[model samples]
Target chain A: MNVYIIGIGLIGGSMSLDIQVTYPEAIIHGIDVSDAHLEEALQRQLIHQKATLQNVENADIVIVTIPVHASIKIIDEVLHTVKDDALVIDAGSTKEQICKSIAAHPKRRNFLAAHPIAGTEFSGPSAAIQRLFEGKTNIICEVEKTAFSLQEKALELFKNLGMRIRYMDPKSHDKHIAYVSHLSHISSFMLGKTVIEKEKNERDIFDLAGSGFASTVRLAKSSPAMWTPIFEQNKTNVIETLDEYISNLQEFKNLMLQDNFEGIYKEMENTNYIKKILKGLE
Target chain B: MNVYIIGIGLIGGSMSLDIQVTYPEAIIHGIDVSDAHLEEALQRQLIHQKATLQNVENADIVIVTIPVHASIKIIDEVLHTVKDDALVIDAGSTKEQICKSIAAHPKRRNFLAAHPIAGTEFSGPSAAIQRLFEGKTNIICEVEKTAFSLQEKALELFKNLGMRIRYMDPKSHDKHIAYVSHLSHISSFMLGKTVIEKEKNERDIFDLAGSGFASTVRLAKSSPAMWTPIFEQNKTNVIETLDEYISNLQEFKNLMLQDNFEGIYKEMENTNYIKKILKGLE
Candidate 1:
């Protein structure tokens, strides 16, 4: 089996790690915009050989894991180069834009739009780890748009990577992700910004911050290059979620201003139900 | 040694677990408003016995772990009953109010205002675990107000429990904690409310959520009984922090509305400094 992985970063490099272990006969070729990333991936054995977009013709499987903005720019050309039997997949965070952008491509049937919901706050080849996708959900959007045999091939690879597959329409996938995933990143990043801005005045404020603050703000450490385009592509949905979130925070502030302790207590009690709901999820 | 723990929930129960192990000869007497909790503490060996506020008269060390609102009401009474050599410390999240409440009490020297910056989202005696305080920061407010010898005694126990001590005035402690601790809880709780409210309309929204959402929302699972009083006690500082937090979110949303991807990306890049700051912290 011949596999070509574009971007050689966390998601691609991690997928390369798992794929090589699962398919010993599969030759992994890495393609990246950065010479440094490609070189590092080779040194780390995340890929077997360095390759490029032109070399994709030889691929039986091609996984594109670049920024969503970059993905839209090249996914058409990637589809143009891959052979008829090849199964191409993208693990971008937002799918609706990419799926829509490639709708008219001649080789569209070979491409799969999947988002494997897995990551650390770190990025790049060095940040990649084996089993990154283990027991995680892989949301495949517009699966019917991909050819049946190619979908089967990608699903087989996903299973080998220890992932659970859930299929959804692109619109629904982007909308749902705006609430669960994108909103949290914005919330976390803004929280980090708010606190750090405060730190300029309050020396050693972080010294007193415990594990709770750390956990809640951890996602602020995510890659801006990656998330910026996600927010751009899913702008409408993200804006909607942000409006709701900001309003919620505003309402909560008003409750405090009004000295409504009972209402505040009730809000927290209601949200505590998240504990039971998230029990088996982690 | 007689060690009285007056509130056997997560914080109190956890301190009891560590204290008993540290002071091997110390008999831990658990006090709670609930009999079931006391009975559970006995069965779990979290405490040697159950006692009430009146029993504090026999105490050499008294630790109050109740809600901050409750702490202010009962603290002076507990200090009145403890012996001159006793160190009565209240581990409440908001220190200024409690500290000021007991300021002129005759037994003022016996009181220590402390906030141990440690805990899991879980609560109750069943949630108690050993080593909870290991390598965690214990913020002591108004330390000089406590009797010097008795302060030394409590400091020794904190060291034995593996905590790092940082001294701050009660006002600064409450102000800083309002930003680091309380603000994060409100953010997490509001985020949880936003998503859960969305889930009511969007079926299976959470299945698409990943570890990021879970981590960011984890604190929302914390007890309402524990946090409501905290928000109430730290109202002014929390309001200030919330104003800045909401304003930050509004600014980000405005950037989104204006299509200022550069500004958005720059904001995230700047806040990425949190990655380095929080490295050794976790």
Candidate 2:
């Protein structure tokens, strides 16, 4: 079996590492826009060979792991070129756009839209590590659109990577991810911008940042190249979530202005349900 | 030596654990409004004895660790009653109000306003742990207001806990903390509230939340009992920081509405400097 992975950065590189371990007989081909990423991926042995669009014709499996916008642009082209029986999967954060782009493709049955809900704040091939998807959730959207055999093959691969699979439609997947993933990156990025703009002295941020600040702002370090496209592809949902978030903050601020300590306390106490939800993730 | 810890919760209880290990001969007295907390502290062997306001008279060192509003209300009383040489320190998130409350007290020189930048999201006595202060920053505001000898004694204790000490004025401490510490809490809390409100299915949140979302919203689980007062006490700074954060979000939302992907990308790129700053923390 030959596997072709596009956008050989954090997600792609990590998937390549795990696939190599699980399917030792499989030949891995890497394709990325950056010469440096392809070089790094090859040096790290993430792929057996560096290939391009032409390689998809021979691939038994093709994985698109680029920014969401980029994935939307290139997935159709890959779908038009892959072997008839090949399983084509994408691991982009947003699903609706990419799934919609290939909806009418003749090879739609061969494509699977998945988001392996895993990543650190770091990006690029160097940030890749083994077992990145282990014990994590993998959300597969529009599963009905994919052929049953291909779905089973993808499930086997995900199971081998130690992932639990969940299924949802493309629209629901976009809405849920907007709140759970994209909004978090936006919050952290804005937080970093707000703090950096206000606190002129970097020494003060260094000395004063506690573990809470570190954890809260950790995603601010995420790659703009990756996230901007996600936000762009899922603009409606992202904006909706952002509006809700901004309104919540404004409400809290109004309570603060009014010296409504009890109100503020009640708001936070109500949200403490997140504690129980997060424990399940752990 | 006798050490009196008021409000025996997370910070106070954890401090007791370390102080006992460092000063075995010192008698530890715990005071708190919550009887259950005192009982748990004693059961955990976090304190040598549970005491009352009367214990302040015998205290050679008094540490005020409670809600910021409560700390403000009680520090003057603690200052008036402690031994002339007893070192009094308050580990509240905000510093200006607490420091000012006791500024004119006769025993003011014995009091040190410090904010140890450490803690997990969990709270109460059970949340306390050994070495909670280990290798973390301890910001001692208005150090000049503390007598030289008492400062030396306080330094020794923080050093024994493996904390690096830095100095600042109380006002500056509150302002900086509002951004780095307090603002992070608000962001997390609001993020949690927004997600909870939107994603009605608790199971969806449990299944979909990745480590990035988990870390970003971890502080949302922090005790409202503790944070409400901190926000109230540092109202001006908190409000200021929230305005900036809200403004940043609004600006990003505007860019998203305009499909200004480049603008949003640039914003996140600029704030990527946070990655370098966070490296120093690790």
Candidate 3:
């Protein structure tokens, strides 16, 4: 099988690397606008060769893994050009926009909207590594729109990547991701900004930053290029989640100001449910 | 030297384990309000024996590693019971309250107020392990209250544990830590709360949670018993820092609502400075 991956950054590049490692016979092709990244990906052997948008026409599978807005545009362009038998999948965070963009495509049956719940703060070809998708969840939205054979092909690919697949509607996918993923990026970015603004002396932040700060601030290192579009595309849900997050923080602040140790203790105890939930995932 | 640890939880147990590995001749005595933790500490061999408050009086050095409020009470209690020349040190998050609690004690010269910037989300004596303090910063506040000779002894201990030491006023220590450390815990706990509230299905949280959420919410797994008092002790500073964090999120939300893509992009782009800061620390 020939796989064409657009935007060979962390997610896309890692997927390509994983596919190549697991199925050595599968030919991998990559497409990226950045000349330097494409060069890096080629030099690192992340792909068999560099391909253009038109090259996706020959692919058995075309994966759209660009920034959210760009992913929508590329998916439309690929649908307009690819073979009817080709399976086109998007690994974008927000699904509603892309699902709507291709809702009326003549080759709509060839497309599948997927979000493999995996990523890192790093980006670009150098950030690519195998096994990034291992033991992770892959949420596929609007699966009924795709042909049965294509859906089977996509499922096999995800299974080969060691991912568990689940189904949901595009709108629900956006809402759940807004809560679980997008809001996390915003919280991390703003926390990073607040601390950076507070300690003008970078040395002080470095000296005092423990693992907590590093973990909480990790997502802030993600690509602004990728996340800004996600925040914009899912603006309404993102804003609502952000408001809920801010209100939670404010309420806790009020409890602290009143020196309500009991209130603070109870609040944290309630939130400590995350431990059980996290362990349950494994 | 004989070292008596007041609380044998994540901090104290980990310290005792590391100290034993690094300094074989040093004997570690354990004390805790919880009998379970003491029993676990002894079972883990994190300490030579479980002892009582009386054990603190005979020690050459006593390290009070307990909650913020408990540290104050223990400091005052130790100040009255320890030898005139014994070094009494604390490893609490907030220094101002603990420092002031022992300000006028006759043994103030022997008390060292320290905050080591290291910990994991897990707590209890079972959570302790070797090398928790390696390559971490240990901040000593209000060193003026400690005798020069006693300060030398405390600094020697931290150095032997492979920690770089920083000296600052207690007020400044609280203010700086409010942003660097305390705010992180609040952000993480609140993020955990927001997600858990949104996704009523705990299984969805575990399934959809990626390394980003895991890293951002890692501190949410911290013990409420350990953190509740910290929020109460640093109530004023924590509330102020939390207000700043909330406003930062609010501003980002406003930008998103306004569809101010450039503003949102630049905000995250600028916050990416944390990467450089973190790299410098490494």
Clashes of each: 0, 0, 0
- Per-residue lDDT tens digits of candidate 1, residues A157-227? 99999999999999999988999999999999999999999886665778898999999999999999999
Best by DockQ: 1
- Highest-scoring model, TM-score: 1
Model 2 deviation from native, Cα RMSD in Å: 1.4
- As for lDDT, the candidate ahead, 1 or 2, is 1
TM-score of chain B of each: 0.98, 0.97, 0.96
User: In model 3, which regions exceed 4 Å deviation?
Assistant: A280-282, B201-205, B280-282
Q: Write the per-residue lDDT of candidate 1 for residues B26-133, one digit (tens) a residue.
A: 999989999999999999999999998999999999889888888898888898888888889888889888888988999998888888888999888999999898
lDDT of each model, Cα atoms only?
0.91, 0.90, 0.87
Q: Compute DockQ for each candidate against the true complex.
A: 0.89, 0.85, 0.76
Candidate 1 lDDT (Cα, whole model)? 0.91
Cα lDDT tens digits, model 3, B17-101, are 8788767898899989998888888888988988899777788889888888888887898878888889988899998888877
Off by over 4 Å in 2: none
Model 3 lDDT at residue A280: 42
Give DockQ: model 1: 0.89
Residue-by-residue lDDT tens digits, candidate 2, A165-246: 9998889888888999999999999998899888765555567898889999999999998898888888999999999999
**Best first by TM-score, ranked:** 1, 2, 3
Which segments of model 1 are wrong by more than 4 Å? Answer: A201-203
